[model samples]
Target: MSQIIGNLSQIGGDYDALFCDLWGCLHNGKQPYPAAVSALQQFRRAGGRVCLMTNAPRPNQYVIAQLDRMGVPRDAWDLVVSSGDAAQDAMFAGAVGRKVWHIGTEKDDGFFTDIPGEWANAPAISRVSLEEAEGIVATGPFDEANEAPEDYRARLMMARERGLVLLCANPDVVVDMGETRIYCAGALAEFYEELGGQSLYFGKPHPPVYDRARRLMDLGDEARILAVGDGIRTDVKGAQQEGIDCLFVTGGLAAEAFGPDVEDPDEELLREWLATQQMAPRYSIGRLR
Candidate 1:
């Protein structure tokens, strides 16, 4: 059985660094949770480094701006690492190549910035349509709030026919945006895969993102690192696979399985849910507080 913690202080001294998930753990896209913010702030004040690791398909600066707008204190985290950053690294490393068809909103263009080369620097990314590109990069649906995977059926079919490999920046299927849940890029990638299109993910539950976070933290020893998040598939599983202990919060993303409202989940119910998912975090909490 997993121990339910009311405060993060119970295990704060056990870790030198924390790789914390952004959306579900800290805020729900609309605003920051006061308790969650205070918990991280408290942890950082205790000498532990807090790195906000997120699958958000935008650059770190965009997320920082959103956090600022939401009134989340700037001191809550020491660093921010995003999936878009990981995808850009993969793109420049010849993993996704230079010529690509970007299938996302205009806000996602930040991922295609210039990269320094050994010579006069490689040209900036050449954005082409599905018919002219060698690969496809998907951040999310063009209209996340109003579109679903079915909306991209025709587009995905065309890409599949052209044999364009997909590089997905965000691995989350759906995200809680304030009071509403919206589809994300991972949902589209799953549809593309079903259409026989090859896809690569650069976010959570994938080793590349975690590897990037570990390098950014530069904290030695995975044993001294604590992973915190709300999703079992992405956060808990990702941390466990990375050989780091995880702390799961029940009130976000996985709230449905925990309880009907944002209260402590039934211990046995949570245990059964984790058993079904084949995940057992080091600790479980209703919220980060």
Candidate 2:
């Protein structure tokens, strides 16, 4: 593992392109981290191609607007690709003229606004059996808090039995929605897998989305991309699996995970943590900023 004392500038040399994660690495969803933003600006000033990749269940434009609202300047990155964008493209690829059952919050429905198809509140709206559904597009968390969780499970089983393709718009299982921890569509997708169902996940930690971002920058797989984010499951694991380096920010997840006592965990502690998991990142930082 390599350690750089200060900001990203300390890391010598310039990369041809950079594939960055959005949520925790760029901002905490509420506000942008000044240091992180400056780091990106510095990288771009050095002529590095930066692509902001996020697992948000919204289109690229929506993600960009959110970044703007969070105070992250438009020049922070060159391009953006959201998990929702990939899911929407995939959905349209298969069912161009068919109807679909959208299982998500109203805010997420904007992804399907321009698609050439009809929307059904529930799978039963089309009088089509779960097996007959052209495809299942899942966006947000569906639980008692917001929606009925049982209804979500039942829909998954129906889709599986009918051999309907399941498309996950949000790849994150949960995120820090400001001070509140809320579940994402990824939680339901995991449960569906446990029940022997097939699902197509679009988001961080998934190779396809990363591949798309790389293509956008014209960078090959050998590019020295640093995946920075606060989520261990998505940012770290995703980077490791894709054979790239990573920088883990400790400001997200269970914020309690890092403290004066546990801060700067020794190599042994890091190894112990990785022993229980299938992947490990190359380095860890307190926070990007």
Tell me each candidate's RMSD, in Å, in order. Answer: 1.8, 4.5
Per-residue C-alpha lDDT of model 1 across residues 1-289, encoded as one tens digit per residue:
7789888999999988889998888998888889999999999999998999999988788888888999999899999998887887777665656689887898887777534243126555778877788888898988987999999899889988988889999998898998899999999999999989999998998998888777877876644888999988889989989888899999888788877656688888898999998998989999888
Deviation of model 1 at 120, angstroms = 8.4
> Which tens-of-lDDT digit does each residue in 1-289 have in candidate 2?
4342345665524456666777767787799878788888888888777788888888888888888878889887899988887776666665422456566767776687644244233222221344556766778763414553455777778767767666788878877766667777777777777767777887877877887787767887567777777677888888888887777665567346445532354455445555565556666666664
Backbone clashes, candidate 2: 1
Off by over 4 Å in 2: 1-6, 12-14, 95-97, 115-132, 142-151, 260-268
Clashes per prediction? 0, 1
227 Cα displacement, candidate 1 (Å): 0.6
The 10-residue segment of model 2 with minimum total lDDT is 119-128
Q: Which model scores highest in lDDT?
A: 1
TM-score of each: 0.94, 0.83
